[model samples]
Target chain A: MMEFLQQRLTDLELFGWDEYINYWFFLAMMALFAFELIVMAFKKAVTWNLIGDSITNFITLFAYRFIGGLIYILFYLTAFFWVYENFSITQLPLTWMSLLGCILLADVIYYWEHRFMHVCGLGWATHTVHHSSPHFNISVAYRFGPLDGFFPFFFHLPLIMLGFHPFMVFLAEALVQLYQTALHTQMVKKLPRPIEYIMNTPSHHRVHHATNSKYIDKNYAGIFIIWDRMFGTFAEEDEKVKFGVYPRINSVNPFTVFFHGFTKLGKQLWEAPSWSYRFQLLIRPPIWAWEQEQKRKREAAAAEAKASP
Target chain B: MNFFVSALSTILLGLVVGFALSLQKAEPPTEFEKYSSANMDFATMSEVGYAMAAFGRESTADYFELKDYQEYVQLAQNDHAKALSASDSPQVAASEAQASKAEAPTMQLAQVEHPAKPKAKPSLKDWPKSVIGIQRSTELINVEKVWQEFASNSALSDQLDSYTVSVFAIYSDFNSDYSRATISIGYDKPSMKGEQQLIPKGKIETLLKPSNYGNNALLNAWQDIDYSKAVKAVVERRDYTQNSELTSLFVIYQ
Candidate 1:
């Protein structure tokens, strides 16, 4: 019986690491959906619009998981593993304390990475899709862009080289992700004050998703709220938060949802007056690109007006 | 054999369960079209209000905090009333009446000969004596339209009926290569603060570039000058890429 079980475990190895992680992640996703349905039965918050948004999100997530396998091999194995094997300061035993320390370190790295994603133009192009949905629900949690998965792993590479096993670092990240999945709903309002103060609750996450002036570019944390508080990106939920991006995307097309920001960036890159301006368009804060493009259009129109007569 | 059967059964069970979960539809698919940018008409909607909240930091005026959509509508009405009253002031009314009379000759000439070239430049002989600060030159562009265009993206125009719109231009004093111009449109009565320095320098040429129509460019046909007040529009020209210093101003009051 033991030999037979061992053989079955080997069969699972045919799918590789991403599938192994995804198999369990898939089950967790299903459980979250089930819980969401149960909450919907009693709460009127679950609308048809949310469901459709969720379906599109599910499709995106499924495709990401499938393609992410290749990304994992190409970028993760070649680059991350090389760093971990060659430059690890020292090996820490896979003990409980080491796991806790790794989670704490990984959470801090995530905070910075998440903040950069919101603040930078190129980063926003990849990350904004997650916040594109106006509706905040369980399905919104699944709205992952393919590009998002490729770059964020670099943030955690430090942890792998600091003597934490790469798998353990990934485990911490997955745990953070699972916690974040629960933060996507409006069903749970403010938790207890201490819990709310210390942890990244739904309230804090809602502020993160909001387009309100006070809320924009605030509250970027993964598992803990301390990082935001320490870093000054923390914003309290003062005003009624409006969800989704500003100058919001107006199309229901999945392609538009996925690629509108990239298209805007691409156009600016082509029309930019100089290489420096083009580089600025790519790497500057998202608002800087938007303002520059607007200035360019205004100048062009003004030129046309002058040329007419 | 028992372990093999158990493993196979677990795999089969997970697949069936996962498929079943996937089949769970989200009631009626969510309506996301309303959120699409195509359906959202920002042009027609008020954008200046949002602009004021978002970009009004540089302005010396007070920022009105709007709590909700209702407050926005209420404030918009209040601002419109303020503007109407400001325009109705005796001085403005007198200037406007005089402006209407002054605008007739140019309109008639535009219709008969050319719309672009009408009337000789206003006589700068009465130009105020220059003291020290940036020089000034005032010109009346025309008197045909009075409208406001929001300068920034994502402004709440409806609630922002009372905000200012600035227009900038460039002028060469026949010395430097590049220069800038600024024209401001607002409910505050226009003032020619620097009207004294309308003295035209050596071979002055107003370079009408494509960038002149930008938010800082004036679209109004005329400007009404109140000489006592700090001129609402600060028009300046500067060296290429040099910090734009307000050197010359052309304010035409109607």
Candidate 2:
């Protein structure tokens, strides 16, 4: 039985089943989203803003796929195969057990990567786009920033070094993303207690998307919520969630939605007092950068008044 | 309008950078090559040693054939001793003697070298006489017609039996000047193992010349192939050694 399963997995890996699964899941999500729109229409909640927002979401998705496709073909494949062939500690065979372990590990890695996106200035500059949508739906799950596809290389390449096949790692990453995509909805409030405790549900993800002070930077899981719980980043759904980033973008234009975070970050870096401050604005937390910018402005105004007197 | 301009400019810059990086054609380092490169730093040396040790411990299957950790450690020690012996000089020998007296057991362990083992080559008498070869360019070739022609010739396909065959296509970077072909024949009956032979580029060119395939238009069509395209052909025959159960020929040309 085990051998049969292993062979099946090997065949699946050979035939690029991961890509097929993702494509099928995408179609299913689109169908579900169509149903969601119908329900919204019945409830008299479907508005032009919501329609425009969803369209922008798909536009960002296409832009991301374009850049991502190039990077994957040109950079990721070569680098991954090179490292796996040369530096891997051992060549792990494709078994059901190994695949399961890889997916679990990839989930843990995603949790940290997701948390990094929330806390670090540069990560947030790319990641804030996903959370910028005022409405939460399946379409919002498709929303992506310009550099969203680039950052995973830093976080997941270690799996290849540790002997997991690059294809297996790719599949695991895709599965994690697909699982999270299913979480981006207002339709399902919560799952059973045990499931909500173990897995990342829509409730947990809604909390993650919320800009409320209590929910900011919380529940950064891709599939399993256990990492967030263990890392003290977990937050339970309590108050009504207010979606979108702080100081909202307030535009549904695809370009605006996609590039707003980076534009805001760029302006801050430009207005920064020194080269070191600009560097800090990149690596430091966004909130910390904002505080420093405010301090710098106050000091500049004080200096200007004294010079005028 | 600003967004479109910026996006296009960024993509153009990315394409330029990606193309430049791809042009370098960096090859992955071999095991000993990694160790040699790591010799520059103490931390890297330790890291490489640990990684190799870990690999030797974990991979003991058919592909790697690393028997055990002790054998792996002994191999490393032997390699170190050989290097020391090759570079020995009078002054170095004296320093080595002094260090040996100071650290006898460690010195003794480092100085022990094992004799290289002679590998037993399989006798060709047990192998099949029939050989089939195919050439492919960028354009697809009809492999079935070539196989039928070879089989009907009787000179190369006298053995009558069943078979299993696998074909693989290998393509190198367009910028790379090197072109070679690899042929491997394996047996599925558990008694015989596969062996690989690499045919050189010059030999391949000679075999595929137009004069060699006179009156055979199918093979002649591939004679005008460009060498700069990095085309590779793989010929595989499986289960042929079974004598009664199998006779196989497989070829991939790209």
Best by TM-score: 2
Q: Indicate the worst ten consecutive residues by lDDT in candidate 2 chain A.
A: A7-16
Give one digit per residue, the lDDT tens place, for model 2 in B20-137.
Answer: 3233322342222121321234343333334433443132121122222234344435545654776642333334333433331210111221122222222222333222332322
DockQ of 1: 0.00
Give candidate 1 misplaced runs (Cα > 4 Å): A1-29, A35-48, A297-309, B1-254
TM-score for all predictions?
0.49, 0.56
TM-score of 2: 0.56
**Candidate 2: which docking quality band?**
incorrect
Query: Model 2: how many Å of interface RMSD?
Result: 17.5
Compare the candidates by DockQ and give the number of the best one.
Answer: 2
* lDDT tens digits by residue: candidate 2, A98-151: 566678778877887887788889999999999999999999999999999998
